[model samples]
Target: MNKWIRKSAVVLISVLTFGLITPTQLITNVNAENPSERDTVEGARLGSYGQEASYFNEAEVDKDKFIEDLVKQAEMQSYQKFGTRIKPVIENEFREIVMPNIEKALQEIANQFPTEDLLNLAITESPGKGQSEKIFNIKNNNTNTDVLRFHVRRDNPPQAGYWFNFHYHTYHDGFQSHHELGSIYWDKNTPPKWMS
Candidate 1:
């Protein structure tokens, strides 16, 4: 008789609460049906409500993948800045001389920041088209601020034709100091305007 009464009370409470406190079996089935919803709820519970739960979990990161992607994007942006006319002439030298330093700089950045912070980094797409001294910038997506800027300036040192001075600036020094990567000589004939 006591067992029967206890069962009746349990059923009555469940009915009145409308499954607000669900059975473990029901929760398991619901979670299986919609795993993303579970993740979202978990994220909310962890105070990462709007953002994906996977992003907050550091274990999901690919480690070197972010740096590799950044390097590839940097190469593409450099070529874009060089354009058709300039690329043909300096492409070889740029690859041999400038690229290694760029890689080093990127690697340095990867080492400096935690992997989770690196995940927030992205390369700016559009390289400057004309005479602008912009190649690409590594920006933090969350803050919308540049963390590193790579640029090439046409330096004509008196009689020394044209030299593309490849360098980068970091946010650490307020983007004022030019940390030289290397330079590629164009010619005495004055190279065409960038991206021409």
Candidate 2:
């Protein structure tokens, strides 16, 4: 009975956290200052309440799989759009900017709970073997709006689509780390915010 109640409570809270509580109520309750829109629920986007935060119990677990995919996709998209010219710069950024921060995020999560080695596997697999050819097809929650970040070699770049996160969970996660050296399609149920 206790376990059942706990589970039920979790579900209820998840629903409540997502705007499932009530639109009129949500607008009145949640504030604009909130960040990183919940991704686990329907209509979840950054900076507001939605599904993602609902199901997410810090105690439940910490597997940043979604973030991992998004980061890889971001890197690949940059290279794809820029070709060889911009690859070096983007690749450099991947090492300098992407890698370190993701590592720190993983540390934070790990310190909080007993993750099943997801973060370690992520780093080892991604940028690990330098299987740099793998491409991740990351799309946004809304099909019409894809979170694609393209790095133009020298000049202008298109200003369209939601600035999506590189991976759904974190950079270089374990779930899809073993991606073969080819094309991989990632369908995002909830998208992350893009970094400018």
Candidate 3:
């Protein structure tokens, strides 16, 4: 039958393609039973590929959930060598810089995609209601690096405005903070350049 031949051909093509693909090249679903390193890390820190250019489509993303996760993660990252607290880094950055810029960016995305309510919601709910106070229990369980940014230019809109960076080194042994200004942006015109 024609259907049988078509199915056989499809299977052959799939098998061939699978053999050619590398482990890193294969995209992982975020909801998988054993999530990939990319899926486990926000923005896919280990790999050069970002969630912006995810091969697997995400129908919905909850911004509040993301923010909540970040807050809980902050707690676990509070203490490092000599029982020093890193709570200030999370609270200060979230309130003063990260949240505001994220809000502005969300507004821009909302304006661009009026019908895409989920996108707007994802941006809006990023700033949580309150701060976490349990500093002692804040463990260093996270293995994914996180980078937060603040707008440099207030006069202009969020999309094209200047920015500052606040990144945490979670992949290594201790929680290291790195502050620098990098040109990381969402280009509506061009597709994301994912790693090969």
Candidate 4:
């Protein structure tokens, strides 16, 4: 009876060991056949499986499209701020001088942020009306904070006519300093109230 019990124990141990090892070996073989599956498993183990992995991949793939869309929105917002009254007067200069700088600044800002963070960026819908000096702001949706603000201030430098000073403030500097993006000269007469 003792020998029979020992034999049964040995068989049970062997079956249990085989049960444990076979699945692992099968998984290893399957992973070896498709290396990407191995990466997926590893990624899953490292906590980057479903949503996070998809977000990272999508951000990388769609980054350029995202930036392009933001640029288009910026242009539209600027035009809206200029309104019908002031747009025709400054449109050409704004397009030629200020727009390029704005694009460059946006590109630089995109470079500073990670793909995930960049994906979360959004442009403010309404540019401030009247003499508010606000064109639009690029903000982080996740943080509910502005990353960069584009403004066109009417600067009257005594002898000079009203100049639309296109500038941006960045979160990096606590939004304090003006980073100029070239300026457009409005006539000596005060320009129409923004969005008028």
Model 4 off-target regions past 4 Å?
1-60
TM-score of each: 0.70, 0.24, 0.22, 0.69
Per-model CA lDDT versus the true structure: 0.77, 0.35, 0.32, 0.78
Question: What is candidate 3's TM-score against the reference?
Answer: 0.22
Q: Candidate 1 residues 89-166, lDDT tens each?
A: 999999999999999998897788787776677788789877899999888778989999999999999998989999
Which one wins by lDDT: 2 or 3? 2
Per-residue accuracy of model 4 over 1-196 as CA lDDT, tens digit each? 8657655555565588865434444444444555776676654433211123434454253556666767777899999998999999989999999989999998898888877666567788789998798899988877889999999998999998899899999999899999999988899998889998
Identify the runs in model 1 with alpha carbons over 4 angstroms from their true place.
1-57
Best by TM-score: 1
TM-score of 1: 0.70
Comparing 3 and 4 on TM-score, the stronger one = 4
- The collision pairs in model 3 are 75-138, 76-138, 76-139
lDDT of 3 by residue, 40-109 (tens): 6643433211223242234434444433443433333322210223233234554555545443433333
Predicted candidate 2 versus true structure: per-residue lDDT over 1-196, tens digit per residue: 8657655655666587774455443443343344444422324422111124444344533355435443454444444533453344345645565455544543454444344322222211122112232233222332323222121111112543222223323224434333111211112232221221
